[model samples]
Target: MTSEVTIRSIQAADTYPLRHAVLWPQESIDYVKLNQDEQGHHYGAFCNGKLVSVISLFIDGNVARFRKFATRPDCQGQGIGSQLLRRVLEEAREKGAQRIWCDARAVNENFYRAFGLEPEGNRFYRGTIPYVRMAKSL
Candidate 1:
């Protein structure tokens, strides 16, 4: 079935449940909470009125970084995450952000590459999960 999906700014609290569900199910919900959340702009994708995808953008002058991006497991491969990323990128550019970056899970490198985000350093591990620093010029 087709559902209407809308992307919009959201409060930090709105992202915690989905982040915990999709990105850190084995850990407590607090595992998904970031100290910088209060200083960032959060965005969510709502599908048929339910929040299904979330991303946070933290800006520092002309540079911006996104963290804790996650989409519900059932919603993966449906392009909802990509739509949310694109919207945030546009918003960042409009706000005069010159660079946007993220520490992306290594497994998802190709997905970020499709959006022009290039890896800048060697892979690193956060606990047991591998990640790479990826960035794009806005």
Candidate 2:
């Protein structure tokens, strides 16, 4: 595995394919209806030019709302997601975000906890998929 991982802004071409690999087939996101430009800030982790992980941030007032954080299944546990997360947070802070937030899958709550995110709101369902809204002060 190449350890030359890179995090950078997402191109539109990367959005659809990654959305399928990450969010589709789970009855969660309606990827076919998504418009990346209107959605949020998108970032990707590239290993030797291959996209292995992806995350997004949407700025609203003093907060940066995270969206569609995903690492390719083959890349999980190798810190690709962590790299993506850290870069997103750094970008958020640079943009003057006072807080950062995301709605995480219940099963992956521990991952967010590692970054200091805590459940700060009620659970929400997107087609029966459970998510907990988490927030962290930046």
Using lDDT, give the best candidate's number: 1
- In candidate 1, residue 121 scores what lDDT? 87
Every candidate's CA RMSD: 0.9, 2.3
Q: Clash number for every model?
A: 0, 0
Q: How many backbone clashes does candidate 2 have?
A: 0
How accurate locally is residue 98 in candidate 1, as Cα lDDT from 0 to 100? 99
Q: How accurate locally, in lDDT, is each candidate?
A: 0.94, 0.82
Q: Which ranges in model 1 have alpha carbons more than 4 Å from their true place?
A: none
1-116 in candidate 1: lDDT tens per residue?
Answer: 28888999999999999989888899999899999999999999999899999999999999999999999989989999999999999988988899999999999999999999
> Who wins the TM-score comparison?
1
TM per candidate: 0.97, 0.88
